[model samples]
Target: MATMCLLNICLVLLFSTEIYSLDCKMLHLQQNKVNMKSLELLSKMGGQFPLQCLNENRNVGFLQKVLRPTESQKENAKLIILEIFQQIFNIFSKNLTQAAWDRSFIQSFQNGLYQQIEQLEKCLHSERENEIPYLGNEKILFPLLKLKKYFERIGDFLKEKQYSLCAWETIRWEMERCLLFVDQLTERLQN
Candidate 1:
């Protein structure tokens, strides 16, 4: 009878261990899926913005004339910012493993993002008063600011060692917000 009781207890412990391992694996997989989807969305949105900006100005003869003097500089700044986004997306795509969420990696990413934000701020500051109407009335600035804030939150997560889906979700939300604003501005410009 004691032997049977010992056998049952052993089996129960083994089964419970297996179940716990399976649960952890599933959670990790879910987190990975969320990260990939978020990164992909960010990549698409980041790539779209520069193209949309270029397209919006294709037929704007009046606006072009007004912005002619500073056009190249403005466009170059936008392209630089776009390149930063592309680089960030590349990093996220390639480093899809759990190590990517490590403190060192997150710190490096945060620094790069902050640099890009500074460049963007400079670009926005350089815009002349007359360029405001053509640039969607400074609608782009808000999204960029919000994105920086979200990145900071991600940095916080890293510092806390809390690599939850919440950080990625926040980033995804900010990216969507930026994309929506850009899309609306593009539509307005097109019309």
Candidate 2:
């Protein structure tokens, strides 16, 4: 009777451990799926978002209220810009490295992104809309320029050893600080 009880207990423990490991594996897979979906949505939205902004319903209305183009908005826009770059960085890291460069895709992605950032900078500068200067006379142009430079460096870094992780880490670190700065600016704007 004692031997039977021990065997049952061991079997139960083993079964529970297997179940937990399976659950963890499933969770990780689901997380990857979600991330992939997000990246896909971003890619689609990248093309559509600017176009949507052009519609009459999009202009001079409640969006201005919700969007609230303050200094904080500019800052937040910068953060989102960085987030977009980081996502691209992650994609590159997953697929390309010192051994291989996804040159065509990277170039195209960066070009599109560069154009979008330029348009956003222009949007910030244009006085026709409810635009505000970001951080004194710097405007939104400075951050866009900086981000452009980073992309250029990333391209150069792709040729070097162990640079895949390094390139991603560099942008990732800056992105956090950018978020914090934007959050502070946002708080001030809210007040």
Highest-TM-score candidate: 2
Clashing pairs in 1: none
Clashing pairs in 2: none
lDDT of 1 by residue, 43-152 (tens): 44333333322322122112122222232233333432443354344434432333323333343333334333443344445554456443363444443444445445
Q: Per-candidate TM vs. native?
A: 0.27, 0.30
Total clashes in model 1, counting residue pairs 3 or more apart in sequence or in different chains: 0
Each model's lDDT comes to 0.37, 0.38
lDDT of 2 by residue, 39-146 (tens): 333343222223322331211112122222352253455343434435454434443443232343344334333333343344334433575544454645554555
lDDT of 2: 0.38
Worst 10 residues of 2 by lDDT: 56-65
